[model samples]
Target chain A: MSLAAFLTPESHSTCRPVGASVLGQRLESPADIADITRRVWQDSMNVLQAPHIYSGVEMALWDLLGKRYEEPVYRLLGYDKAFAKQPYVVVPFAAVPEQTFERMRHIRQAGYRAVKTGWSGFGHGNIASDLSQLAAAREGLGADARLFIDAARIWGCDVVAAKRYCPLFDQFSIEWVEEPFDPTALNAYADFAAHHGRMRLAAGENIHSIQQAQQLLNIAGIGVIQIDCGRVGGIGAAKEIAQYADLRCARYINHTYTSHLALSASLQAYAGLERQDLCEYPMDPTSLSWSICREHLLVGGDGEVTIPNAPGLGITISLDDLQRYVVDLEIRIGRTTLYRTPSIR
Target chain B: MSLAAFLTPESHSTCRPVGASVLGQRLESPADIADITRRVWQDSMNVLQAPHIYSGVEMALWDLLGKRYEEPVYRLLGYDKAFAKQPYVVVPFAAVPEQTFERMRHIRQAGYRAVKTGWSGFGHGNIASDLSQLAAAREGLGADARLFIDAARIWGCDVVAAKRYCPLFDQFSIEWVEEPFDPTALNAYADFAAHHGRMRLAAGENIHSIQQAQQLLNIAGIGVIQIDCGRVGGIGAAKEIAQYADLRCARYINHTYTSHLALSASLQAYAGLERQDLCEYPMDPTSLSWSICREHLLVGGDGEVTIPNAPGLGITISLDDLQRYVVDLEIRIGRTTLYRTPSIR
Candidate 1:
């Protein structure tokens, strides 16, 4: 077989390229990927005991497997059907409620299908002010648009408080209330679900793996199982969770308030899922998603973006862009450091 | 209202004596109990931000309410009918398999009707080793006895691992498999349940409050919702969870690997439910349950204990035994320290 190439710019040149030769095994199938990844994980655990350290390696393996199969990673993972992604833009909280309302309008005008706002001012302070902001956002986005409220885990609403306050958002036509309480408080989540049966409760962005996703979705009344590929291990794990969510009849919303790389990865995974109805597209103006990649994977006028078809993540990394934004850089070969930028003094 | 009495010996005198006067209210009804507990909980959260700190106070409130009503706390909690207690004794993991076998025999001979063992010898070991111990216990206890396996969250088996290992226990007539993975691994638990469709999965003892229990019970495939009153806030919270579990058609098994006081407390909560089928009675010889209370809440030959009918928590507090067993004591009066034991010389 011809050499499978991956470019590494001068800054991160020491990082090893992944291929059959580098892995010391022929990357012929998913079984081979599993065998190598498991061994790599075992090796890491025996030495460093850091399971998270292997995620990047595992994701890269999936990319290579995609290239090897001459297909998108989703299709390689057996998702043959096409998915039309209807993206939702998150309207991050502004100190001024009116400014937040304006941003919600901008999000709708950006051709986004849906919008999400936060609960910064909801649980405490002037709840009426928060309610008004939600109402304004709903009004700005128009009646046909979907609106979601993300408490972002800062809203310290207990089940009782959540029950008392969540329904107040219903008048604005809130699609779902996300993370109204401590995520660990699953029962509290259930109570909120029970009390606000009319409104949907969504979670799982902070959830760590496919297994945790399974548990969260198994929660009888949970309506949405939010998936962020970066937080939930990697694309491999996300696909597994998305499949499980489909089986449970829960909505799979790719949580994409992450970097361009992660959002692209999530898009690839979402492309193959049957329930790819809506996804998070960090459409917030201040987000770094647009600037990080050489080529923009922009959300079009209809609120959808084409899944990248290029081999291995389908986006070119701009070395200048990485250097401009990165706080520090280091390159290592085994235990020896090949290079590292000097600390900014 | 007249002053109510409580006996707090010198050793545990640091523990507050609960009364209507101390609570600064007439503890005349369950409504009053609720009012006080909520206030106490709010005050603690405001000052200390630790909700767990108020559980003892909340439990004491239940005791006060029970005393005022001249009934068991369960009856005060709205369980109006008779319930016959059927108990299961937990046979915690023994060092040796044969020793475990002997302990199981002892448990049956001790008049317990059902038995529970641990996962130390199961999951990873040759399946037969765990199976033999279970079979030996089953044979000793007779075919009619119910057997359970408590992994105690040590098995570390994922849903895949659980699916592979759980079915092997079916021949031994295992009642349920308890927490084969980290309790936080809810997805793993769900997956295990999904795979082992024939076997029942039980959990919730480590759960801290009624909300969590409700969440765990709300999880699909969990057949048994185990409640340890001490861990689950108080008898008040346990009653709430038991009620929810009942509605979900899940079995309510009181978890009692605790002191006699907590065991008695759990029994009170257990005795009120229509599903008062099995409560855990730690039958290990080394357990303090055998000698803590002045009068033993003895298990009959048929493996049951009558609910303590005395006012409050029905069992007599053995002062001498408490003093002997207690490692240290402290008492506080509002912000002032009333007493604290001297450090060991």
Candidate 2:
């Protein structure tokens, strides 16, 4: 279980953040570098021993290891390169209608089989208007593509949101509706599930810990349990919960914690995991989506990513890349000027 | 229910994060930030209907407000600050033997009623030496003063840990031993707890979500339940579990996510709570232990902090103070050179 053996044989390499010119520190030891990643992951947001608490690092270290490992991240996670395509989503929150459609078209062309969209707000003025948008969005996705509408629990259109949403779920043939109304709304969601049990609900990554996962599972028995590994702190706990999901007949989906390494580690946790569907490959357009980790995650022609073949994680760090773009870690901007401290050392 | 009315008419300073510092953009309505806070608090975390995922930020805001409001956060739920003095422990870690004792004397000088120490390792040359250290540390603490000892539960010390550590607890007048092992080792911790129930069994904040809390509560009630507001993702969920503890006749303590504002907020919640003892206040020297919401949490002369008396937590964020320290929201620190990103603009 020690990632040591797998990590032992790697030449050090540097990590470059996307759009940045300078190199980050070149990692010397994969295991030691991995420890740094783990600590950072633990310190942010979620601080509980909840369902899971995971830590990961190695943008600089992972890069060196990737080259030494001679394979990508997916292959390391036990994913076969043949099925190297990844399941993904397109968040159309701030996009115009045409832009969203265009984005979806590009994603489709780029080999993604499914796309999720329409999450900013349900601004239909009424439930009917919201429903119409869903109908149209589904039509745009067409029969060949899978479409997910992220309403973010805007199901408060009174009777429409509560009673009518599920039927609409069936109408649009939605893959699964997420956080239709937050955790408290589980009973309402359950009510929907009880009646149109076929309308499949997807949620849980928003949950910060395992105990919450257990409560959510007990309360709703969700169709697709989307687990956010980072929010819980790390991959180990997610592994346990994913196993529980497999045993319980519910599908587990990796909840995104905003980085490819976080996403990749979760993909590994899902290895041999039953009832698991997709590990959200957050391919946002921001340089952030590209530079946040040590390596750029890719999907193969088969619509899945081959898990990293190297030990620990076959992450490739590019210090030069990250330094090229980063000016500070904690930045503050006022209307007149931005206050930033460069890494003087 | 709202916090605005509690503030003096002249109180209107707002602390804006430098990156988003256009002050008036949010002050459109009559000074009613608490109105929004209340709504977000109510709708998102608190009263979030069961089976919902709780986020920590929402609760932290509430905790911050409670301090600002000069009222026990729990007082909002209609409970009073029950204790006359806020009894808490200063964590002692990362210190050599002599230095740790020297620091303990200073903690005593600061008027703290109790102190807790972290675990180093347990065994020596493998086993015997480590246990000897534990005994020496316990003896040292007792030699200087009567205080509580928190076993750092570094794991793998067999039943000897249980037997040796269990009796040492009584030798030091240690009220309750913390985690001491993995979460699943409920039996092991319980075994130790059973060995000393009259002293009061303490645990939780590590137990994520309500489901795990339920498991802990079921495994024979511990005297004190420490819940971490950050880990649980907000005050609403923390309260739900705290209230559940009230229902079950167990005491609850806040797990430390100790920002000055958060501490005040916890005091407020404790005011509203029925069953709960002191919060795990981190006395270690970190900026986090003091202030973060652009406010200072002043402890009352009585030792117990008087919960905020103003609307929300009565915290007035100082934009100037925030600007002084925050460089970037996220920085990538590698083993060698840490990257600095430009200030958020």
Candidate 3:
């Protein structure tokens, strides 16, 4: 079953934290964000598969806190000014070189300075064409723009193939490879880094906490640490990781593939970084960045979007938007809306 | 606010493990259980806090697997007969000596050979009276029977008071002191264990994983390891911990203070242990054990319980019992039910 289905709007209130000390206070402190999210984390940790639901709640918290402090969420995280807000467009891979080139061209034309493409047909068949497609995209984006490739890690790329193709893409000036292999394969990463000096490896989205981030950043090859606030507990955890990542000299990037709500949180978190690199933006036209709170997340002619300076994550939800976009239907099994045996204690 | 409230019967299906490979297969192998619980553990590791709800689902899994194999759940874990089925009655402390003696007398008369009392009046005012009460409990149980003291660690006992009184109880042949200090205070436990040679320090239920269990068991002072199936992920995780505890030469006991559903799982797991020790049984009349599934969980005249040999945890739930015991009213909210805006992704 989909997690999105169970994280119903009605259920959000049940997961919200309760404490008298913070009851009347503003949600500005990183501790406040952690306190709120950790409650939900502890309550749902054994049941929820991916923290996707908690991720949404964490985004809401950042928005609330940003609004409460009359600053963007990132500024609450100690950003004196907006950090580098230039994001790389995460473009899905195409089967052919023309489709890949077309996507890269669209990204460049859209004023995006960088583009990341997925490995659509990497190992299925015709490895040469896939490498050619990467070359075509790099050539299309031109030498001035940045290019990154995502292996999706779960697909299990062959070490031999990664060795062969990494250098091939390095010739195309691919800045770094995102999850070129499994993140859990630490030895594989060390081996890859030892062999492929030309291509840097980046990963952090799957790393769950400050501890996990520290461990991953310490790995020899991973140069970029991509942190998702939701996955790492909350904004506080992400900021702590960002600080740790900077101390270790790793480039910090925020992973926001969800709605503008989460993107706002990511942007805020990235603002707290000492050495901010590039954050991920889902450039897919179908993404909620365009349809839900589209105006705030829009890109400018300078190949970067400004951080929303409005209170909270700088976005507001209207009931009309909820009515138009959200699917609301009562899901009932018999007469019981909430079905479970009452607690004995 | 209670986990049992959230882990309703309807939601059990959502958290239960799935996958075609283990769908029809019997759950006999430790590896199979590890695979199943690990999937849930990984899914909920960062988001969900305490795994209490997931622990219930784990119990259900053990029950299902037990039934499928036509062997007692313990037998599936490699046991021939019931593991030390005799349990210690977790007797709450009474303010007066008569109350303590009377309770211990009832425990002995009821065929329970072992009794554990709480550290109620120990640190509060008079330490002598509390020691006298424990001595009274000892005299009431007649010396051959086992006696344990639960400090309830969360109550925050003073170190000076514990140091003063632990030796006094030891003089009365108190078998072990349960959580004399904080579960997290490894140094305190080690120091106490070094000084107090009379009573062994016991702990386990609060621990959440095999790693934590290993760390706690390695402490020089702790002598008994209490494994709670729910607190430690599930039966597989608890079993792994039990094996580790045995290797360390610590006595193994199952911690079950909840419903009979969880107790059966704990008992089954305890049956797999090589050094089977006395398990905990809440003898309070108000407990769900009396009202929920009273007959299935009844202790025999020998103060021992036989593992449910029936398919799946051996105990079956009746809708009539649920109707009588469960709360059926909807928990009302002052505001709109669906407060949070829907997710954009």
Candidate 4:
């Protein structure tokens, strides 16, 4: 799952990389990173998986460039300094309303100014059950805290089905309804956006390319553009979308639900954009995800999280933890070894 | 590289597929095929590679369905009969105009009523060179032959560069200009289409899903929508695009270059549309590609190709050739064998 790209001053190259896990290639400029992204995209022609695989390689490229230049990734991305982002406690909805209420109450008690509950059978059931869940979440989070609903695309382009929850969204004071339809369903998104009440439509997390992100902004009529650096061809593409969204006068936010390394990578893209203040924070990550990085971007007393000023992604990887969680893999074609697990060290 | 899906009446299943190579699952209806496609898409979240891998599976599903019902795949798709398609002889531009002329002449002498020359340094060079190539192609093909130019997307998104060839396109009576830019560069396509004269803009060979194909027709403003059945989620998706194009008053054509099996699969989608007669025929495919299928869709005396009236794809796979070309592959994670090459038999 973790992929790294190493760079050296000599042996300049274009397409030769070690394997999917490690990009043993040279890094020259930002264009080289874009070239690599395009090459990977063209090679596989899988917008989603190619970006997912190369996102790590892209992060590694930026990390290498940042380290070589003795600057943080944000600074390398033309940012003056990293700004603090208001972290929203992201939690999946529980099976029942009471559980959801308790989960929201705990998040509110933890001093989070915003909370997002998504994708644990939240919108899959009847409207009454969804209403109950939304009511519980709002009541538990208190009237002042911002509440966000992540439908997780349960409606799947059913504008009418999604519209039924508009009353719940408005009644609960939901800031935005995220991904109520398939990410690529632009027409459905536009239709829903036109009819939805006060709550704004938000999407773009599933987008892998900048063209697609631009399409979402241009055609989907969504207010907020959420990008996951780990999935959207890494930080460069995310930054491009961020700039495009800024020009379009749309809100931008990072979507991270994995390790702190990923969180830092996601944050660095729009780290200097003061207006895009909100960021997703993984409240209940798996043990492996939590242990992958040595340092975490912790929420401050002001309920804001800031990226590290250190070089690269500004997060340290735990070699021991990586080794502990590594799954030894090998792929062979005939007698030739196509790929083998690279040494963690 | 080949993937297969097997269905049995007794073992009713949803998601349990054997591996990337074979699907040991049941498919009850067209909805099941769609369900599998959606599941594969959701699993990888890849529009391209996921469809690519699933395409063979999809073809297998259709093949299975057609076999079980004693009908051709087109019939299963609700087509009354497979219509004849004008087979266009597809060739690559030689290094020089003389060589291009010779190739086109040979295709014309062989009784191909249409010719398409692409890639191999056609539009990548100066406009004069491209014009000479186009002129040579037209001169060699004679005045009656339908001439097409496949730019092979060498210009990327440079509308100005592509615009420089409009005069040549019009002067040569080129039927269409194929893929002057990247497949996803819809805006560039639209911009180029706006200014380009006479010759229609053609694209969509790289499209993986029906959504993208629809986007090309709806936004790119292209007149011809070309789909590769092997890549665009197989026959069903191709049919959907074909039907969509027909409704939009745009011409639909199949883009196949690999094997006759693929050509047959591609042809089935639009076999009922008589007006959409053009079909890509590989004039010089790789030996292995030619050897994969026992029965080839050869151009008839009328200079047209037609699908077989037999059940399923009608083109039989050469099992011996498959065994001959098979490369034993194995993917192991720790001590568990995740995948091994399935038997050709």
Q: Compute the DockQ of candidate 1.
A: 0.04
- Candidate 3 structure quality by residue, lDDT tens digits, B261-286: 77778877767564575677765557
Fraction of native Cα contacts kept in each candidate?
Answer: 0.06, 0.15, 0.02, 0.57
Fill in the DockQ of model 4.
0.45
Docking class for candidate 3 = incorrect
As for model 3, its CA RMSD to the true structure in angstroms is 8.9
> What DockQ do the predictions score, one after another?
0.04, 0.16, 0.08, 0.45
Query: Which prediction has the highest TM-score against the true structure?
Result: 4
Give the per-residue lDDT digits (tens) of candidate 1, residues B199-231: 378887656556557556555357788876754
The per-residue C-alpha lDDT of model 3 at residue B342 equals 27
Candidate 4 wrongly placed segments (more than 4 Å): A1-25, A38-48, A197-199, B1-25, B41-48, B197-199
lDDT of model 3 at residue A80?
81
How do the residues A5-95 of candidate 4 rate in per-residue lDDT, one tens digit apiece? 2111111122223243235445787777777766665444422235566677788889888888889999989999888998887877888
Q: Quote model 3's TM-score.
A: 0.64
Off by over 4 Å in 3: A1-69, A91-225, A231-233, A299-302, A329-345, B1-62, B77-82, B85-228, B231-233, B236-255, B276-285, B294-306, B327-345
What's the residue-level lDDT of B142 in candidate 1?
A: 77
Error of 1 at A3 (Å): 52
> Candidate 3's residue-wise lDDT over A50-116, tens digit each?
2544555566767776666687777777778875567887776777888778878877886888888
Candidate 2 vs candidate 3: the TM-score winner is 3
Error of 4 at B183 (Å): 1.9
Model 2 scores a TM of 0.58
